[model samples]
Target: MDNLLVKTGSSLKTFFTELGGISIMVFKAFAAIRIRHNFIPQIIEQFILIGKKSLPLVVVTSAFMGLAIGVQVGFQMTGFTPHWIAGGMILRTILIDLGPITIGLVLSGRISAGIAAELGTMKVTEQVDALRSFAIDPIGYLVTPRLIAAIFSVPALLVFSNSIAILLSYVSCNMTIHITWNEFVQGMRYSFYVSDLMTSLIKSLVFGVVLISLGAYFGLNCQRGAKGVGSATTLAVVWASVSVFVLDYVISTIVFYA
Candidate 1:
């Protein structure tokens, strides 16, 4: 019992410490962005990196997941006359939960690792050293644009995902069963409150910051050579996903009682 208590206490302490580090990373990222606005090429490159590169995967995942959600909900509502209550249900789930969450997760999995690996390689290869040697402020040049791009790109992905998910789900509803578009959309509008949509957007922003920060932190701080870079890349995605869920719970709880 004593050992278990000690272990639990140690876990809590580590958790808090990590949380504090994450917060510091976010603050530094914003500061870097402020200092690095002159680098238009870097900023645009990040837009392509974070937004364009991720679009295909985001679109694909949103469509299939939306269809799956429609199917499951349709199965559950089969006893109903129209059997098309599922469309609205799918829309609600996608808009309020899965759309943002899915995009956030995919961003973390793909872009977070990319950022970590890139920065980690730079760190190990002395490119970062060169920047520091030139007094270029490595964080301003390296972390800032990526962070800003993430803030913009994650939401862009979410907005696109939401539209795709809704469209695909609507297609599934009409194709599988036969519901009027007006009725289906009406049900969706009624079921999905604007407030929930706002909640989802807020979650996406938080997720964006968390994932980017985790990647930057792990990458910038990595030790050793190629092996350490690889390890940091893996850890960045893992920790980003974990932090997403943890932050999701906190957001949900606050929204619930607010």
Candidate 2:
């Protein structure tokens, strides 16, 4: 019992310590931002890296996600429930929850791991030290661009994902239940709201910040070794994915229930 209690307390302390470190990293990232020549170019490079590179995965995932939702909706339909209702269910599920959450989780694995590995490699090789030796702020040059790119790219990805998912879900609905495009769209129009769209965008934006910041924090603070770099990369992905779910629930509760 004593050992258990000691372990628990130590874990909590480590959690808070890391949390404080991440918070400080975030502050430093924003503080270091400046509209210099390198800044724009770096941001553009990140756009290609974060946005363009991520597109194919988003497309494939959203396509299958839409198909699954449509099939499930069809399976659950009864005589009492109109077939058209599938459209609203698919739209709401995609926009209000699944779309942003899927993108967040996917990017948490891809983007977060990539960021952590890159930075961790640099840290382990003393490249980060070299940057400091040159009087260059690593956070300014490396972290800030990624953060800014994520802010824009994540939402753009979400929009594309939502569109593809909804469209393919309609196709699936047609194949499953023989519903016309017009009927499906009518149901979507019936249930759609400006606020639902806003909720999705807001969630994507927050998810972007969480994934990038956590990745940067873990990478920059990694221990000194190849094994340490691997550990940081794994931790970054794990924590970013968990944070996405937690924040998703929080955002939904505040936006829809509160």
Candidate 3:
């Protein structure tokens, strides 16, 4: 019992310490954003890195997600409601919960790991310190662009993911339940609302901020070795993924209840 208590206390201390560090890093990154010569160019590069390169994975995952939801819902709704109801159910699930959550988790694994590994490598090799020696703000140069890119790219990705997921759901329903495109479209129109769309966009935006900021924080604070870099990379993915689910619940409760 004493040993367990000691481990629990140590874990709590580490958690809060890392949380404080991430908060400070987020604030600094936002403050570092400025209209400089390198800002736009670097942001453009990061947009390509974060947004474009991530498309294939997002597309594949979302398509399969939609198909799975469609099939499961279709099976459940059989003989209970009209085939069109399956379309409505699938849309609601994708838009309100599954779409953002799926994309967030996937990107948490891919983008967060990449950011942590890249920045951790730089930290371990003292490249970040080299920027300081040259009188350049590494946070401004390295972190700001990625932060901005994530903020913008995630919403864009969500939009694409939602659209693709809906389309694939429609296709899957057509194949499995003989629901026509018109029925699917009508069902979507019947159930869709502006508020739900807004909530999804807001959730995606928050998730983007959380994942990228945590990744950068872990990477920048990594210890002095390859093993430290590896640990940071692993923690970056794990914590970012965990944060997504926690934020989803918090945001959903607030949005739905308040």
Candidate 4:
């Protein structure tokens, strides 16, 4: 019992310590944005890397998710109800919740893991120290661009994903229940609201910041050697993914209530 209590206390301490570090890193990255003037090119490069390169995966996953939701909604509907309502359901589900959350989780796995591993490798190899020796602020040069790129790219990707998902859902509804494209589109138009769109974008932005900042934090503070790098990469992915869901709930509750 005593051993278990000690372990639990240690784990809690580590969690808070890491959380504090990530928060500090995020603040510093934002501050560094004003001080660092030469990262524009790198930011653009990261935008392409984080946003453009992620399009294929986002589109494919979102399309399939829409199809699945459409089919399921169709199955659950009674014959008396309009089939067109499936379109509204799909649109609402995708845009307001699933779309941003799904994109965040996907990026958390792909981008966060990649950032952690890349930075972790640099840390282990003394490359990060080399940058500092040259009077370069590693956070300004390395972390800032990635952070800015993520903030820009994630919302863009969410928009693309939401559009593709809606399109695919329309197609799926037509095939599944013979709902016409016009009816599906009309249903979507009727149900759509500007506020919902804004909410999704906000969620995407927050999730982007959370994942990228955590990735950089873990990578920068990674312990020595290959094992440490591996651990950081794994933790980065896990924590980023979990944070997306947690933030989703918190944001959604506040949005709905407020």
Q: Give TM-scores for every candidate, taking all chains together and pairing residue i with residue i.
A: 0.91, 0.98, 0.97, 0.96
Per-residue alpha-carbon lDDT of model 1 for 1-258, expressed as tens digits? 999999999999987886787677777767766643478678789988889999999999999987877666655665555544565677767866788778878888888898899899999998989999999977778878877777787887888888888887777776666666887877776687777788788888888777878888888888889999989999899998887777877887898786
**What lDDT is reached at residue 109 by model 3?**
90
Worst lDDT 10-window in candidate 4: 31-40
lDDT (Cα, tens digit) per residue for candidate 3, span 1-258 = 999999999999999998998888889999998888858998999999989999999999999998888777767766758877777788888888999999899999988999999999999999999999999887878888999999999999999999999888877777788888888888888888888898899999999888888788888888989999999999999999999899989988998899
Local error of candidate 2 at residue 196 (angstroms):
1.0
* CA shift of 159, model 3, Å: 0.6
lDDT of 3: 0.89
lDDT of 2 by residue, 174-198 (tens): 8888889888998899999999999
Off by over 4 Å in 4: 35-37
> Where does model 3 exceed 4 Å of error?
none
Error of model 2, residue 6, in angstroms: 1.5
* Model 4, TM vs. native: 0.96
Global lDDT of each candidate: 0.80, 0.92, 0.89, 0.89
Overlapping backbone residue pairs in candidate 3 total 0
